[model samples]
Target: MNEPEAVDDLIADLPEWATTEEIADTMRVKPQTVLKWNKEYGLKTVAVGTRVRRYRKKDFREFLLRSAEATD
Candidate 1:
């Protein structure tokens, strides 16, 4: 891939402090799923502002790694 494409891919892979909607779009999952995960797993998150929720990059990476370990 070109430089820009590589950068975009990296950005996609990196954890972004994004809303449930954004996370759903990126993960190809539903927004409800994200909410459910938070409720069920006590996943770390932050409130950006009024009615705005976001996940940190480190939290997302750790979650992914944990899931992968479970599967393995």
Candidate 2:
């Protein structure tokens, strides 16, 4: 039998969390818009120190879905 080769995990290479700028780019909006949503919609974030914050990939994806549905 041929030996199996190790493969890289493409999804794993992707960030487990996203920054505000990243989310804004994905949403086709400005970074400040992401911040606004964070406040008005109660979108969640994790504080990485006392200064930096991150949003979970899953949570931000869900936020996109819910916001899209709301517009329809």
RMSD of each: 6.1, 9.8
> What pairs collide in candidate 1?
none
Q: How accurate is candidate 2 locally (lDDT)?
A: 0.67
In candidate 2, what are the lDDT values of residues 2-55, reduced to their tens digit? 111211121223366878877776657898898889889878888888767799
Model 1: lDDT equals: 0.67
On the 0 to 100 scale, the lDDT of residue 64 in model 1 is 56
Clashes of 2: 0
Q: 31, model 1: CA deviation in Å?
A: 0.4
TM-score of 2: 0.67
Residue 59 lDDT (model 2)? 73
